[model samples]
Target: MKRLEGRVAVVTGGASGIGFASVERLAAEGARVVITDLNEATGKAAVQRMADAGHAEAVDLVCGDVADEAHVADAMDRAIDRWGRLDIAFLNAGVGGAFGSLLETAVEDWDQTFAYLTRSVFLGIKHAGKRMGEGGSIIATASIAGLGGGAGSHGYSAAKAAVISLTRTAAMELGPRRIRVNAIAPGVISTPLAHRGKESNLEALCARQPWPDTGQPADIAAALAFLASDDARFVTGETVTVDGGLRARSSDVLGDNSMLLAGRTGMNRGSTGLKSGFRNTDR
Candidate 1:
C-alpha cells in the first residue's frame, strides 16, 4: 500500500541534501510534494528530475527564501491552492554559517543563522498549522550540535538548539488539534552542508563513526517518511537523532578517557582553553 497516498507535503530546502531526499521519498509514497528552495534554477531542475523519474504528477516547485515570512506564507498558499490542503511540513532549510570563536563571531552572522534555521521553522509551523486539519505532521531539521557543542559551529549549534526546543514547545501547543510536531537531529551527513560536495572527505570522516559509513541524505529521509506516516501518529514533541552513532561516543573516543572520567570523580580541572566536554563534576 502507498503509505502517503492522497497526502500533500511541503519540503523547504528541497533543492538538495536531505530535503531533496525527503521530497523524493514522500513522492514515492504517493504524496503531492511541493519543493521550496532559494535557488530557483536548482529547484526547478530538481522537480524536473523528479518528473523524469515518473513523479511528474506528484511534484511542484516553489522558490523562495524560507526566512522571509512573506515568502513562507506564499509557499503555503501555493501548496494549499494547488492541493486544497497540506498534510506534512518539513522545515529543513539552513546555512552552514560563519565558523569562528565566540569573540570572533559577528552579531549579524548570528542573527542571519537564527533567522534562517530557527525562525524559518517557527514561520513554517505558524502558517502550516493554520491551514492543516487534524492529522498534520510538522518536522524540522535540527542537528546533533543542538544537543552539544562539538557537532557544529557556534551560530549553527545555537540555532539548531533553539529548533530542538521549539519542536517540543510547538508540539505542546499543537497537540490539542491532533497535529504532531517533531524534529530530526542528524549527525555528520554526506551533504554539501557537511562534506562540501566532497565524497572522499565524507568517507574519510565516516571511518570514525560506529556505523563506519557516512550518513546519506536518504538515511534522514527514511526517518522523515516514518514521522510523516501513520506509523508515528502517537509521536510528537520528540527529537529523533539520526547520527551514525557519533553522539553515542565522544569525538575523542579512541583518545584519553581519563580527563572526562576524572571530571566524573569530582576533580576540579576547570579551565577556559578546551571546549565541549563534561563541565559539571557533581557526579
Candidate 2:
C-alpha cells in the first residue's frame, strides 16, 4: 500500500524549494495535499504543475503568509473542509532574515526572523494539533545552523534553533494523543534561501561539501515523507539531520596539521575529557 494513503496534509511555503518538493512528494505518495504560500501566482502554478502531472485530484492551494496565525488557521480549516481531516502538517516556511554579525544585527531583523521561522511553526502546531486525531505528524524545517555555528546566519540560526527546541517540547506534550512532532535540520541545499545572490553559483557551493554533491530539495522532501508516514511511527521529539556529513567533522579535523601537535601536547582535549586523535588509514 502507498505510505500516505488516505492522508490529508498541509504544507506551508509550498510554492518552491524544499516546501514545494515536500508538497509534490506527499501528494505522489497518496495523500491529498493543500499547498499554502505567500505568492498566489506561484501557488497556482504549483497546483497547475501537479494537475499537468496528473495529480490534480490530489492537490489544492492556499495563498497566505505562514507567520500569520489567522492565515494558518484558515489553511488548516481549508484542508479539513476539503479532505474531512488533517493528518500531516509541514510548517516549512522561512526567511534568511539577518545574515551578518550579531553585533551589527538590528532588533527588528531578529524579531522578523523568529516571527517568520519559529513563530510560524508554533502556530502550525497549535492549530493543526487541535484538529488532528489519533495518528498525526507535524514536521518543521530547521537547519544545521540550529545545531551549531558556521552553518547559518545569526538570526536565522537562532530562529531555527528555537524551532528544534519547540519540536521537542511539543512532542512531549502531544505524545499522549499518538501525534508525532519532529524537526528536519537540513544542510546546505541548492535553494534560494541557501544562496542569496542571483549570480550565486550552486555548482561551486556543491564542490565545497564533504560529499561534493549538493543536497537537492527532494532529499529533504523524502525525509519529510518518511517522518510523515507510518514508517516513523515510533520516532518523535527527534531531529533528523540531513546535512551530508557537514556536521560529522569538527574544525580541528578539517583544519591544519596544528591539531596533530595539539593532540600530542594534550592541548586538544575536548569536552569529553579526551584528546582529539586523527588517524589516516591506507586502504
Candidate 3:
C-alpha cells in the first residue's frame, strides 16, 4: 500500500513551486488532497492538470489568501468534508520578501512579510491541528536563511526564523495528540521566487552551491512526503535541512553570501500569500 493510502491532506500555495510539488507527491503516495492558493485560475488549472494525470478523484482546489484565517480553516474543512479526515497539512506558501537591509526595510513591509510567511503557518497549525486525528503530520516551509545570518534579506530571514519557532512550539502541544509538526529548510532552490524571474541566473547560482545538483521543488517534496507518511511517525518538532550540503560549509566559505546582493535596494516581495506565483508583487 502507498504510505498515505487512506490519508487526506491540505496544501497551501499549491499552484506552484514546492507547494505544487508537495501536492502531487502526497497524492502519488495515495493521499487525497485539498489545495489552496491566491490565484484562482492557476490554482484550478493545477488541480485540473492533476486530475488529468489520473488523480481526478484525489484532488480539489480552494482559491484564497493563505494569511487569512478563514481560508486556512476552510481548506482544512474541505479535506475533512471531502475525505472524512485531515491527516496532513503542508503550510508551504511563501514569497520573496522585503529584500533590503534592516534599516532600509519599512515597518509595513516587515509586518506584511510576517503576515505572509509566519502568520499563515500559525493559522494552518491552528485550524489543521484542530481537525487532525492521531498520527497526523503538519509541515511548514522554512529556509536556510532562518538557520543563520548571511542567507537572506532582513525581513525574510526574520519571518522564516519565526516559522521554525512555530513548528517546534506547535509540535509540543500537538504531540500528545499524536500529531507531528515539522519544518523543511531549503537552500538556493531553482524556483521563480529564488531566481527573481531569472531562471538561468538562479540555476547557475544554485549549481555553485556546495551541492553539485541544484535544489529542486521535488527534493523538498520528497522530504515533505517522508514527514507526512507513517515513516516519520516517530519524528516531531524538527526542521529538516533539504539544502543539500550548502549549509554544511561556513557562510563565508565562498566569500560572504550576503555580499551577493549587498547594497542592491530593490525588494523582491512576491504574491505568495496573495498568490503562489513567484512573480514580483507591487504590494
Residue pairs with colliding backbones in model 1 are none
Q: Give the per-residue lDDT digits (tens) of candidate 1, residues 1-283.
A: 8999999999999988898999999998889999999877778888889989998888888888888999888888888899899999999988775355554445766676788888999999999999897779999999987888656666777889999999999999999999999999998787876765467756645676799777889999999999999999999999999988977887553333222333332111111111222223532
Backbone collision tally, model 3: 0
Angstrom error of the Cα, residue 261, model 2: value is: 30
| TM-score, per-candidate, Cα-based | 0.87, 0.86, 0.91
Instruction: Check candidate 2 and list the clashing pairs.
Output: none
Rank order by TM-score, top first?
Answer: 3, 1, 2
Per-model root-mean-square deviation over C-alphas = 8.7, 11.2, 3.5
| lDDT: worst 10-residue window of model 3 | 273-282
> Which lDDT value does model 2 have at 193?
57
lDDT of each: 0.81, 0.81, 0.83
Give the clash total for candidate 1: 0
Model 3 RMSD, rounded to 1 decimal = 3.5
Which candidate model has the greater lDDT, 1 or 3?
3
Clashes per model (N, Cα, C within 3 A): 0, 0, 0
TM-score of 1: 0.87
Worst 10 residues of 2 by lDDT: 265-274
